[model samples]
Target: MDKIVLKNMAFYGYHGNLESEKSQGQRFFVDVEIKTDLTKPGQTDVLEDSINYVEVYDMVASIMTGESCNLLEHVGALIADSLYQHFQGIIGLSVAVRKPSVPIAGVLDYVEVVTTRGQI
Candidate 1:
C-alpha cells in the first residue's frame, strides 16, 4: 500500500461544545492520510490515474466550513466518511482534527482528535 498525506490544511469553523465556540468560531487544522495503491499513477504519470489533490482539498474545505459540529471527533468522522464515499481507490484513511483555541483552564498548545476508517 502507498500513501497520500495532506497536512495542516487550516479552516475557520464553528465546532465545539461551548456556546461561545459555536458562535464565535475558531481555527481548525485538518490532516489527512490516504492509503492507496500508487502503482498506477506512478506508472502512468497522469492525473486521472491517481486521486485528485484539489478535489480532496475542496471536499475537506466544504465540510469544515459548512456545518457546525459539537466535537472534533465528529468532524474527523465526517471527513473520513466523505473521503471513503468520494474516492473508491482508497484502501483506508485517517483524519486528524485540531483545535488550537480550546477553553481549557490550563495553557496548552491545542487539542486534536483522530479518526480512522477502513483498513487504516
Candidate 2:
C-alpha cells in the first residue's frame, strides 16, 4: 500500500462551540492521509492513475466554506466520506481538523478532531 498525504491545509470558517467563535470566525488546519493500493498507479506512472491532490484541496476548500456544520468532528468525517466516495482505491484514511482560534480563556494553540475511514 502507498500513502497519499496532504498536510497543513489551512482554512478559515465558523466552526465552534462558543458564540464569539461562530460570529467572529477562526482558522482551521487540516492533515489528511489516504492509504490505498498503489500497484496500478506505480506501474502506470500517470497522474490520472493516482490521486490528484489539487482536486482534493478544491474539494476540502469547497466544503469548509459551503455549509453550516457545527462540529469539527462532523466536518472531518465529511471529508473522509467524500474521499472514499470520490476517489477510488482508497482503503483507509486519517483526517485531522484543528481549530486554532477557539474562544477559551486560557492560552492554547487549538482544538482538533481526528477521524478515520474504512479503518480497522
All candidates' TM-scores? Answer: 0.97, 0.90
Candidate 2 has an lDDT of: 0.84
The superposed Cα distance between candidate 1 and the true structure at residue 26, in angstroms, equals 0.6
Q: Write the per-residue lDDT of candidate 2 for residues 27-119, one digit (tens) a residue.
A: 889998989877888899988898888988888887777675788989998898998899987889999999877667999888889999886
Candidate of highest lDDT = 1
lDDT tens digits, residue span 5-30, model 1 = 99999999999999999999999999
For model 2, give the RMSD to the true fold.
Answer: 1.5
Off by over 4 Å in 1: none
Cα lDDT of all candidates, in order? 0.94, 0.84
